[model samples]
Target: MATYEDSKSPEGPSSYPISHTISASDESNTNMPSWDSDDDPKNPYNWPTSRKWALTCLAAFATFLTMMNGTMATVAHFEISEVFNISETSFPHSYWIVTTWALGGACSALFILPLAEDFGTRPVFLSTYLVFLCFLVPQAVAQNYATLVVTRFFAGGCAAILANTAAGVAGNVWSTEWSRSVPVSLYILGYMAGSSMGPVMGAAIFQSLGWRWIGYMQLIWFAALFPVYYFFFHETRGSAILTQQGKSKDKGNDSVGSEKTATTSTSSLRNLTASATRPMILFCTEPVLFVSTLWSAFTIGTLFLFTQSVEQVFMEIYDWSVTQTGFVQCAIVIGECIGWSLNFLSRKLYLTSTSRNTEVPGAPIPEARLYMAVFGGVFGISGGMFTYAWTSYPHIPWIAPAISLTMVGAGSVLVVSGVTDYVVDAYSHYAGSAMGAVATGENIFSAFLPLATFSMYNNLGLNWASTMLAFISLVLSLVPTLMFVWGKEVRARSTFMNEMTEDGSKRSDDMV
Candidate 1:
């Protein structure tokens, strides 16, 4: 997720930067509404700590729910296949039931993020969630496979807002770099927990109430949450809030005149077009972003692939039931918890590095954020994958593979969260586009990777298929270390970075 600013540079067209921390003095002459003072109650950044945390937790919970919904169908895949008369031998088509959800999210997110930026997070959250709930009903009552797949796509689209926007909300509430990691980590924890626990909980539901109940449970949960969000969820996007304040005070002669002028249909279309295209532009043009997002995507894709592969390996080798296989998925959850605990150390290291950088008082080294990512990629992901691959035998104890899963989970958290933090810091001005690129890649990979699961396991055998994936991960694991070594040079040569610096210098001159 990316935070956005409404302020435009005097020398160029309006652009949405990821974070804007300009002091009041810097903006005093600008015709835009800002917080009345640093202590203004209306500023989300100045809200009571307890209140900020409350919203953070709520946003995290929403992420948990949406992610859980994404994978809960995994445990019920067999039942759904049977219900829809899908052939057991169908290579990947049957798996589309799970894949479409992520595909929908990926496809819709480009538009959804822009919509949130235009209107406000609160209304977008509420409206999309309501639509998400409505789509869930059809999933519960689908007449055929097409109906189920179609409805899942739309439901997933609506749900994308929750998963992607929570980070933006986190950025809105936590203005400082040092304090921002806590909420972002919480958000990642919620995402991982929901993803890991979904199949386990869904297995229980499927056994007790059948597969349709999976959809029913989602509907019930989402329906219950709608009212709570409607009543309590406040707009946290700083620019959106300021826009509202301007309108409320005096629409005709307010500080929002510049924003109003940019609202013409031509300008609106241009902004929307830029919002939709800029992420892809950055993803393709920036080497740092390309490599970072690719690494994150592979890690996330492998996680989703495990949903199917884990069930297959355990059920066949150990003769575990669906419910039992589901329970074992908790190993990943355990690993994620350990990875999250390790993040505190990373945070401490980040603070220490920032304090030591006296040459640039407040500019922390972004490479400091990659320490855990390197550890995660090398030990957590690659080692776990190898261990799991070589240990899955009928004679071997099941605990071996389970423990490996724990390693993979922990590694996943470390890598994903670390990359996110690094990108946000490295491209703070355009964090929105950078993060958007990463999110899109993640969804694309997650959506398509599992489609190869059955075919790969069948053609190459379980051990070899797993080994191939592990090798790919192992090779990619070096990304963090390479970034740590040469990231500054890479940034220096980056076209985007140079443009941003030029823009910032131009803005400073204009303010002066």
Candidate 2:
């Protein structure tokens, strides 16, 4: 008989039915393959520390490749434009070359994430990499603007799975909020490093070997990584693992299990579909989500804006070569390192503050996640933008403005990571969809915003144009501050947050 338990346990609610007697009868239950206990060897949660790190490294590697591909073409834009017979006068249009990748990711994640929820992260992970390879071949040999743009678009759509689902993989393997921080932070580090490194790598390759080698290099790397991915990865999604266990049961004696299997599959499908569409609803209805999405999207938009404008600024004012300009982009990387450090410190603060009351569990107060973000968004980004804005003259030391890039990078990650962790806690099982909602907005901004970078810089002039951006960043910084102050009130009314909380997690009554 199936059993139910309802006590406040560290594992949360015992929602799943368990056959308590199965362990006593070896033969009759021999085929059953569900987790033996919360500490079962098959559960990713109970895996050795070495094993967990392996999964983290694999996911981070994939994230790096995806993000690297997105921006590698940025530094090669001039060469690609020259070959297509396009003029510097039309350079702004070339932003589409970069934008389309993010646009494709934004569009594809809507469907891909849902399917991942249904089938399992393992299938989506493998299939999308194949899609990446397929598009790289066309992009490598493309002779015209249309071919290159179309190929990059599809390649980006395929690669969306990596950015959208890697965190979900981390979520699957590490069940607790605190346990997830380091791995998730590492994944974000790889992702940001890829974005920072893309231009540098592309610039070196294009200057030495020409633009086509960019695609060739990407293909070679993907080919090398695919095998590592296929071999090391295992199924970590709990629902999917349970479904497999149901299928493995003996036919005659497992009638009840079969019926339960059908019900679980159907329910999973419904949840998948719901997750696909739920972001739209939450975007409109959930105040916290709305604010967090807007802040992150704007931060990403500014980052892309810098990506397009930074090379031009250094090249035009400092008269740096393309390769040198790419090196200058390291400002953002330094900033990201600092941001990661701040994230580490923030995690320590969160753990220490909450440890005072180990009686409760789940994520700490949602607002606690926003404290660093509020400060980061308000000061780090605004300070960097203003400093960079006015300091960009031929006489001023380039290091002055470059230092500002570090601040921008730090602020962006703090805001992005903080808001993301907040949403992940708030929406737990549906974290995939919650994160998808955020990525949808973030990528949409990334896709379209850079197109105006040159126009703004040229028409408004450098100081004022960047000043304008700084003003906007300063204004939006209020979002996280507001969230930090009133986040609980905002979360209290959220149906999704409440459901996840009341599902027997200690976070529900913490009243933070």
Report lDDT per candidate: 0.73, 0.69
For model 1, residues 1-512, the per-residue Cα lDDT tens digits are: 11222222211111111122221112232545667776677777777899888888898898888888888878877777888888867575666766788888877775655556656667777878878888889778887999888878887777677665654566677655445667778888887777787887888888899888988988887888778887878878776777677677865675556556555345557656776788899898988888888999998888888888998899989999987888899899899999999989877776566555432444445577788788898899999999999998999999999999999999999898888767755665566667778877888898899888988988888798889988888888885687666766776788666443333322222211
Models 1 onward score TM values of 0.89, 0.87
Which portions of model 2 show Cα errors greater than 4 Å? 1-33, 88-91, 250-269, 352-363, 428-430, 498-512
Candidate 1: segments with Cα more than 4 A from true spot:
1-30, 251-264, 355-362, 498-512
Ten-residue region with minimum lDDT total, candidate 2: 15-24
- Model 1 clash pairs are none
Q: What is the lDDT of residue 302 in candidate 1?
A: 86
For residues 347-414, write the lDDT of model 2, one tens digit per residue.
Answer: 66555545442324543444566678777887788888998888999999899889988899898878
TM-score of 1: 0.89
